[model samples]
Target: MKATRQLHDLGQSLWLDNITRSLLDDGTLARYIAEDSITGLTSNPSIFDAAIGGGDAYDAGIHAKTLAGLSGEALFTELALEDLRRAADLFRPVFDATGQVDGWVSMEVSPLLAADSAGSIAAARHIHHQGRRDNLFVKIPGTPEGVPAIEEAIFLGIPINVTLLFSCAQYQAVAEAYLRGIERRLAAGLDPRVGSVASLFISRWDVAANPQLPDALRNQLGIAVGQQTYRAYRELLASKRWHKLAAAGARPQRLLWASTGVKDPSAPDTLYVSALAAPDTIDTIPEKTLHAFADHGQLHGVLADDGGDADAVLAQIAAAGVDLDALALKLQRDGAAAFVKSWQQLLQRIADKASALEKESQLP
Candidate 1:
């Protein structure tokens, strides 16, 4: 069996970490969904930036929106929404088959609002409505301020994919926010099955810790953190509090592993995919990693529910003088900033493309 199918059979969801007009126009995304067990997809400012700026796939839509007097963020949103809506439609059947648990496509709110709770909530609602698809998730960062917005968006029935989490503590905060939202829904006589996922980034942890660790610990911190967080996830789902919420018709907000692609060229390409496998969890992998896994990646045994050897690995790193907590914070902050940078560059690239296209058209 293909490793992607093996992973899916082992109960880990495989979601494509990309979306683009070309992928949609060329049917590549659909093929992955049909053949590679890619039940879902996720997108962000960076992914969209690369997709739109890397080629002319988005030019016609950008030109039309430009003619309609839309530019900057507004123009970008319209273009992004077009791609996301199409991707969401492609996965709708999987979503329906799984009763809303599996197939989902995520579009992030502006990274500029990462720390703006009110603004994030407003933008989330706006984006969710604009997408108009039941399977769409608006991604919110898991920064301190973003926690409240996550809860508010969930309580308001806007499904969310909480992103940029880097450690167990960050994951807990996002989970608590999700629980609060579901609890509020129960109180307000709403269905408590509103969907959500707390996305803890994996590879960035190792990247952030690389320079601080010795040779033996290289490329190991991220999996250790993921193991610890997955342990927390299992414990949380089985707890009395979660059971109480479950009894009230609330679905457990799933733990997702984001940034699963290995960044270090020397490491195995499917390092994160093989190590972090667990039931009831989602791993959104970059397109290259997904293909690599399907081609030759091995499915190491699934992660231990009890966080097998996680503490020991973490303690070894700690003994080496790495502060996991501080590192998590730094990675989260840096990831948000990186997305903002990508967002600005994306806008500039789109504007330049629009201008060039106009000039070409005027060459009668």
Candidate 2:
């Protein structure tokens, strides 16, 4: 079997961390679904920025929206939603087959709202409603401000993908927000089956810490962090609180591993994919990494329910003078900033494309 199929069979979801109009137009996304066992995908400002600025594939859409008086973020939203809604339809079968646990695609809210709880909540609602797909998740960052927005969005029954989490604590915060949302639903006699996922970023830890660590510890911190968080995830699933919610018909918010693409050139291309395999978790793989893993990735057995030597490795790193707690916060903040940067670039790309297209139209 292909390695992608192997991972899927082992119960880990492999979601393509990419989306482009070309992928949908040329059937690549569909092929991944049909052959590579890619049940879902997730997109962000960076991904959309690349898709919009990379080629002429989105030019026509940009031109139309521009002519229709849509520009900047507004234009970007219509363009993104067009792709997401189509991708959501393509994954509808897997979604239905798994009872909504699998075959999900995510769309993030404007990173500009990262610090505004009210704006985040409002954007999530508007985006999800505009998306019109039950399998679509509107991504909200897990910042201090975003936490309340996440809880409110969940209580409002909008499926959420809580993004930018870096450590077990961050994951737990979002998890608690999700639980609170479900609990609120139950108290109000609402259905508790709201779908959500707490996305923990991997790889960035090593990218940030590697320069300071000894060679032996290089590239190990991310997986260790993942292991630690996985332990927390398992414990939560087995917790009395979660059990109460489950019995009351609330679906557990799944843990998704983001930033799985290896950043170190010396590291094995499939390092993250091979190291973090586990049941009931989602790994959002970059297109390049997804192909590499499918070609030659190996399963090194599933992650231990107890987190294996995660703590020991973390201790060694701490001893080496890397403050894990401080670093997690830094990474989350950095990640959010990076998204905002990409979001700005994306809007500019749209404005530029629309202008050029309009110029060409006038000549004709």
Query: What shift in Å separates residue 24 of candidate 1 from its native position after superposition?
Result: 0.9
Give per-residue CA lDDT, model 1, range 80-181, as digits (tens).
Answer: 989889988999999999889989999889999998999999999999989899999999999999999999999999999999999999999999999999
Candidate 1, poorest ten consecutive residues by summed lDDT: 204-213
Task: Compose the digit string of candidate 2's lDDT tens values, residues 1-364.
Answer: 9999999999999999999999999999999998889999999999999998888999989999888899888889889999999999999999999999999999999999999999999999899989999999999999999999999999999999999999999999999999999999999999999999999999999999999999999999999999999999999999999999999988889999999999999999999999999999999999999889989998889999999999999999999999999999999999999999999888888888899999999994
lDDT of 2 at 162: 95
lDDT of each: 0.92, 0.95
Backbone collision tally, model 1: 0
* Candidate 1 stretches greater than 4 Å from native: none
Best by TM-score: 2
Candidate 2 to truth, TM: 0.99
**In model 2, where is the ten-residue run with the lowest total lDDT?**
344-353
